[model samples]
Target: MGIVKAAMAEEESKRQTAVEILMKVGFLDHCEHHEEIIFTVGGDEEVTGAYKYGNANWTAYQGSFKDRKDMTDHIKQESENSDYANDGCEICRSMFEKD
Candidate 1:
């Protein structure tokens, strides 16, 4: 594979691992929005996990069960952060924005 394709595959692998961890910890549902795949654990609209892609890098933020709300809030805030938004890659944007 080409270097860029390889990198994307690696990033996807990282995101899949994060999803498994979050699901194991009770994050039951997930949806793609902008540059993030947001996972929810329970009744709250808060996030239990976030898989973020920007600048050709992927970042996984997982919330602890005991402090899930805070983590979710942080994820939400980070998603809207100017730095992240400005650095987002077009490929990542196209992949996630379809839904």
Candidate 2:
């Protein structure tokens, strides 16, 4: 029964992993899963966040989130404080926290 139990455990782990990957990539709809998770956001690269889909590390989709709150919050938290700011429009600037 040990082998059977181990196999079941491994299958359960993989199933959970797949769900996490799908959710991380924006297929799942809500922050409840990560509501309490610590976030470490960084600078505004060509894209803001990375998600894994299938077997790949994927950047956030353009116009994915309903609003910028999730993205902006992540960016503000991740990005180091910078004196050099990009000249951005209202829409673009909304994605970054104002000083």
lDDT (Cα atoms) of all candidates against the true structure: 0.41, 0.36
The candidate that wins on lDDT is: 1
Off by over 4 Å in 1: 30-39, 43-99
lDDT of 2 at 67: 36
Kindly report which residue stretches of model 2 are placed more than 4 angstroms away from their true locations once superposed: 30-52, 58-99
22 in model 2: Cα distance from truth in Å?
Answer: 0.6
Per-residue lDDT tens digits of candidate 2, residues 45-78?
3123322133233233323333344434333332
Writing each residue's lDDT as its tens digit, candidate 1 over 1-99 gives 999998787655544554444344443333433425443433222232342221112233332222344444434444343432233355566877996
33: Cα error in model 1, Å: 22
- Relative to the unseen true structure, what is the C-alpha lDDT of residue 15 in candidate 2, on a scale of 0 to 100? 39
Best by TM-score: 1
**Residue 30: error of model 1 in Å?**
7.3
